[model samples]
Target: MNLPELLYALALQHVPNLGDSTARKLIRHCGSAEAVFREKKQNLLKLNGIGKTRIANLQHTAHLKAAEEELKFIEKNGIGVAYFRDQDYPEKLKHCFDGPLLLFYRGNINLQKKKLISIVGTRNITGHGAAFCEELIAGLAPLDPVIVSGFAYGVDITAQRAAVKHGLQTVGCLAHGLNQIYPKAHRKYMAGIEENGGFFTDFWSTDKFDRNNFLKRNRIIAGLSEATIVIESAEKGGSLVTADLANSYNREVFAVPGRPGDIYSKGCNDLIKSQNAHVLTSAADLVYILNWELPSTERAVQKQLFVSLEPEEEIIAEYLQNMGKAELDLIALNCKYPTFKAASVLLNMELKGLIRPLPGKLFELV
Candidate 1:
């Protein structure tokens, strides 16, 4: 959009309590943000869901002044802006009802035909959870998917770092404005992430930093991806909120299952029990469920590797290889392993890409 149009849109976005959905309605009805400002109050009131209270600040001079200042910041910092109606806006996010009217970002981030996966979890990440987050990214690296996260501590940072290590794009969604970085300790990662994938936010440079802002930003993280994965979450946390947002968007939500008694695992276990999220034991489960196409070269290379299997996993794989495809119980019986033990081994084999699970609890070599 032109500078004049952006100024008007930003001002409209600056109006207090004027939500994105409502803003979109106004823009659609008025033909443009500039037109919305010129529209008569009586005409705007005629639109459904528009009320005096909601548009009370619509004509405020301060909003336009703030927008002017923010525009200066955008110009000075070389920030990229994505208007909701524009082609450059994130395709997945545009479908969300409450998506940001204006999305500001910085870096060489590219989403064209890219596979977007979001990984979220507790800021106080456990060692096991961190390992799993990294391993999951490593496993999915061959497909060259773009990793999306909140850029917070724990699972978010772990996933992004793994993406960088694997030479994949990683976008960090920020809670605050682009003027500064939160958790100041992460300032070091700015250059590297910007060099590849960068940061995204709807907040302006002048917006106050508040805790509630973090909750609001969760929608962006959830909406920008094809699927959102929860590495580990407590019974109540932001990651759970993100999962809920993803579900609301009708996107796939996956949670890493933890032991029933573990504190961090309770949220994931409950999500699985309630059927709110798919059980994410391995990256293979995500790939299979999403039906993402794997590269022929990577599949060929994976089949050639035969290392890193435990004794039990090797036994299950051998049984499946010989039988072609055998029921879980039959494999357990033939391998002299307990049913539960055999199931665990099969999961490990799935993680290693050695075998795949079929219908009716059957197993077959991948």
Candidate 2:
């Protein structure tokens, strides 16, 4: 977007009562944000969901003034701006009904043709949770998926650091703005994170750091990814909220199960019990559920090369190859192996790229 269009979009975003969806509606109706300002109040009111009060709010001069100042900040800092209607806007996020109309970002972030997943959990992470989060990212390194999180403490930082360690891009969706980093201590990790990915937020530099900002920021974390994974969450926490948001968007949600009595495990356990999220045991589960497969050429070459598998894995693989496709229990029963053992073998084969998993617990030789 040009300077004038950006200015109008910023001004429209500055309107207090006019939310992202309504602003988008008005922009679509008026052809442009610049045109929306020139539209008659009576005509804007005629649009469904736009009230007289909202039109009156749009008439305020203060919004434009604030937007002008924000534009100056963008120009001075070399910050990147993405308008919702532009091709550069996040494609997955575009599907979100309440996604930000404009996003301001800083860093060398790229999402094109990249697998994206958001990992979120409680700020007070447990040792097991941290280990699981790190291992999950490391295991997923082969897929080179983009890791997104809030850039907060505990699970968020753990996941991002693991992403950087694995040479994967990681995006930190901040609750505030690029002007500052929350938790203050995480400022040290910023350089490494920006080297591959960077921070994103819709809040302006001048916006205050409020507790409520995190809830609004959670949507971006959930919306930016193809799936949202909860490493660990308490019964009531922001991570659970993000999971809910991902489900609302009709995207996949995964949760790491904990012992029934564990405090941090309650939320994830609840989500799984309620069928709101899939049981996430390892990176293989995500790859399976998302149907992410290696290139057909690569699979064909691997299959022809006689790649080695464990004796048990070979038994399951041989069954799958002959049977076409089979579910977990069926494969175990036909192979005369225990169901738990068969599940583990399938996951290993998936990680090795020797087999592909389908929906409904089905597996087939790649």
How well does each candidate superpose onto the true structure, as a TM-score?
0.86, 0.86
lDDT of 2: 0.90
The ten-residue window of minimal lDDT in model 1 covers 297-306
For residues 186-248, what per-residue lDDT tens digits would candidate 1 score against the true structure?
Answer: 888888888889999999998899999999999999999999999889999999999999999
List the candidate 2 regions with Cα displacement exceeding 4 Å.
Answer: 295-366
Assess each prediction's global lDDT (C-alpha) against the native: 0.88, 0.90
Best by lDDT: 2
lDDT of 1 at 65: 94
- lDDT by residue for model 2 over 1-366, one digit each (tens)? 999999999999999988999999999999999999999988998998999889999999999999999999999999999999989899999999999999999999999998999999999999889877876776677678999999999899999999999999999999997888898999999999999999999999999999999999999999999999999999999999999999999999999999999999999999999999999877767877898975454444455467777898778877987899998889878999645456666766766777887878888988
Q: List the residue pairs that clash in candidate 2.
A: none
- Poorest 10 consecutive residues of model 2 by lDDT? 295-304
